[model samples]
Target: MSASPLLDQLIEALRCLPGVGQKSAQRMAYHLLERDREGGVRLAARLAEAMEKIGHCERCRDFSEVPVCPLCASPARETQLLCVVETPADRLAIELATGYRGLYFVLQGRLSPLDGIGPRELGLDLLAARLAAGDVGELIIATNPTVEGEATAHYLAQLARQHGVRPSRLAHGLPLGGELEYIDRGTLAHAFGSRSEIPS
Candidate 1:
């Protein structure tokens, strides 16, 4: 009448993922153990690999396997133009959706004082140092349209001004309260293309 210990453990572990409830976790556990053992093994291997190898980029703070991410190391990317994003996923979405060839500064998270996340926690000090280094000419804030994201963008904009760099925010194509990672490619591209200057 009781499930095996390993099966129960797998189901519980799956529930740790966002939006996955107990029922969904049980279904996934059964699907993986019964119908797709090989796929399950591959997933386990990949997760282990990523967990062990992935670390934040020294310059951009995005997840990377090396000191710097490939995009940051690329000579083709414009060093003078920097895009600010809330997470590595958001940066990836913008890169895939837009014609942007600039460097990026991943905040790793946004301001959430209630949750105890602030400028120092998001590596804003490092960003300010980079801006003040004078290699960057512009900062494009591509944070999500959420309240926390907006506050983060505004704070970064102030930092940009203090460092004498131009500041801008993504345009209106992205819907209000929408996260950048969930937006469609076309809409993201339009928003990036029509980005407006933020007086700083």
Candidate 2:
């Protein structure tokens, strides 16, 4: 049972997205062909356009349509405080928590030595330089509670000490190895409120 050439190609491409299996891709592909042909074209066009237009922020490496992201570019956001996390979604979680009013620096990914993601890959060197230049006051580590996340946080805390600055990791309560994106607002807020310094 083979799909038509065009349908098979569509299915293959869409399946590249996370959580989208062959069945889901086939369903979506048929839906696009039968009902949303123009809509599908528009979606593809918009995706391409956004990819071309958006780049990483100069300051925090968050996705940006401009050189700097909205939060980093805005003058009103607190410049002294910094929240470091693995992805933009993690940043969104802190925003949802509603307690952190400061700016953020997104690592885009966390350190995993087994996976070959190291300090240079995570941009800790860049962060160290930024803090040393007196660009921030306190660095709040909001990375997830997974093994790699904890490793990354510990590494950053140690790096900050060499620069004579202190770093703090979020307090326990996020469920061991849990991600920020899935946490509820109350729990996230409590984590932020009760954050403890990563011991030197």
Candidate 3:
């Protein structure tokens, strides 16, 4: 235990961050106190402000300071195509990696009955309402390639069909530049099974 209770508390608090263990937290706390007190103060202030002010967007459920996020409000986005992602980070990755001009609906999490996460928790009602509004013609399921993600995608697809919207899943297969020999068996099998004809 540290001589100072406050120092021990600070180290413990730092451990709350992902992948930060006791040793890493202690190192961070020492670094902040000994080398970057000003930076620490700024970080604390910003973190506090963000925790207080940042809220989910009313339409897309992405992090926002206002009722609707800028993406949802922007007219340039395609209203007919709505992409559903499990998290804000996933949404950001798609925005950065793709030329997709569609709007989004953040699921926040996939359905995991074991974890008690359900459709209600993931805001399916809002998505259903959006689909029923008749603007979206396609619902793109961008959930991860996991059991929970697939289950969620299936449920979303059914929901879309009920609303007369076409449901599509993001294609999953081999990675670009990855050789078939080095690929995992599951990925290889999936890629082989999902192989499409070459364009003329």
Please tell me which predicted candidate would have the highest TM-score against the true structure.
Answer: 3
Global Cα lDDT for candidate 2: 0.86
Which prediction has the highest lDDT against the true structure? 3
lDDT of 1 by residue, 56-81 (tens): 88999999999988889999998999
Q: In model 3, which range of ten residues has the least summed lDDT?
A: 171-180
Q: How accurate locally, in lDDT, is each candidate?
A: 0.92, 0.86, 0.96
Ordered from best to worst lDDT, the candidate numbers read 3, 1, 2
Q: What is candidate 3's TM-score against the reference?
A: 0.95
TM, every model: 0.83, 0.81, 0.95
Could you tell me how far off, in angstroms, the CA of residue 78 lies in candidate 2 after the best superposition? 0.6
lDDT of 1: 0.92
Is 1 or 2 the stronger prediction by TM-score? 1
- How many clashes does the backbone of model 3 have? 0
Off by over 4 Å in 2: 1-3, 174-200
Clashing pairs in 3: none
Candidate 3 lDDT, 1-200, residue by residue in tens? 99999999999899899999999999999999999999999999999999999999999999999999999999999899999999999999999999999999999999999999999999999999999999999999999998889999999999999999999998879999999899999989999999999999
